[model samples]
Target: MESTKDYRQLPNSSDHYCFGCSPLNPSGLQMNFFADQNTVISNVTIPDHLCGWSNIAHGGVLTTILDEIMSWAALHFIKRITMTRSMNIEFIKPVYIRNPLKAEGKVLEITGKHDAVMEGILYNDKGVACAKSTARFAIFSPKVAKRFGIADDNSLNFFANVFGIK
Candidate 1:
């Protein structure tokens, strides 16, 4: 297991205006995750502004959280940066905007050289599974990483620092 201190620390790039995990995005989810053994766990509070129906969180918003958590699980646990190739989600119950949600993800399997299968679940404050997702991720290459503005050396170091690889 990686050091707990390293797992708990957010990468410097985590603040890079990301809609899901950026702390600087006021309109973003600002989600924070913790490494749990080989998985990643996070709690998300749905705001009223993110609702699709009266007092209920939007399905799209929930999907984004699941995607983010699953991607992070792949990167942190599988030791690779990746982009989602496809994701399938299942909505089991309505997510209330007034309650916090628990999101957890783990790497299910590696299917190919650059592809992985990952799974995630979202649970309401009452611990009921409200949603779940599975996704395929394609490993990021230098070219694709550069196109996303994520290939900077400083950014790589930031990730390494957070993951305790250095």
Candidate 2:
């Protein structure tokens, strides 16, 4: 039975402990991403406790947000499991805490077998582009997924539903 879900999100797991995008992690960011065609988007509000300085969002957190959006983009948009290959980020402006931030990612190209290039950008509450990033990823094949122990029935089912693959 193919359960075709109308909406798409990065697949979740029971024990996912990712600080950037895990709903199960109590002290984590708990980011939720949505797909609009090939673009992956997430809205986040940086908390005061996550600041590096007096009121600025931590640079590591900002980079994590960028990495997450782009990684999720590769997952749902490419319909494949992947690992980030490399990332380059540029911070254009300081991000303040407790502000609505928008993170967006898109698939730039599929370079080779199970490999792709992706780009991401972060915008502040004032609609200013505060940061930008680009990266490459290694999408996994079935054999690789099995070897990595991430290819479970639940994940496959979730992917199938989101992608309408009967």
Candidate 3:
């Protein structure tokens, strides 16, 4: 069964302007995600402006999407702020512009107290894997993220509310 619980974006007061998941950025991807058990999924359609060659989605944009989803996966499952330490992507087929696509992410393993490995896959409208990614993420607690200047107070508050952190 599919999960109906959607991940909420940071409030405007957080000044969130991520190119991948921020809803307030006019030129951003504005992707939204939901959780299915331990997996995070986003359904998106690449706009014409992000195309690379003719109708194909840009490789950089595809990479960003994969990174974003995997980051979210690590955040949601590991309950921490996540940064991509390293990543690898494999493009199996072209993702065409102006077409429905699905991106899915899941935590493959938590290697240590603060490190995780996650995988993301982008699927075309036909449910074929168009791109695949595996990433190592560095995870930090909310307080650690705030102390390290990775996230401001408002952003940390938003995450605390959503993830039930104190």
Q: Which one is best on lDDT? A: 3
Q: Please, what are the lDDT tens digits per residue for candidate 2 over residues 1-166?
A: 1112533555465556789887887767788877767688888888777899999999999999999999888877787877788999999999998888989889999998778999999998777899999999988864567678866666666656665322
- Per-model TM-score on C-alpha atoms: 0.86, 0.85, 0.90
Better of 2 and 3 by TM-score: 3
Residue pairs in clash, model 1: none
Best by TM-score: 3
In order, what lDDT does every prediction score? 0.81, 0.81, 0.84
Q: Please estimate how well model 3 matches the true structure, expressed as its whole-model Cα lDDT.
A: 0.84
RMSD of each: 3.9, 5.3, 2.9
Per-residue lDDT tens digits for candidate 1, residues 127-162, read 889999999998765456767885577656665666
| Cα RMSD for predicted model 3 | 2.9
lDDT (tens digit, per residue) of candidate 3 on 1-166: 2233564432223268898988788888888878767788888888899999998899999999999889877767787888999999999998898998889999999999889999999988888999999999998887888888999888788777776555
Model 3: weakest 10-residue lDDT segment is 5-14
lDDT of 1: 0.81
Total backbone collisions, model 3: 0
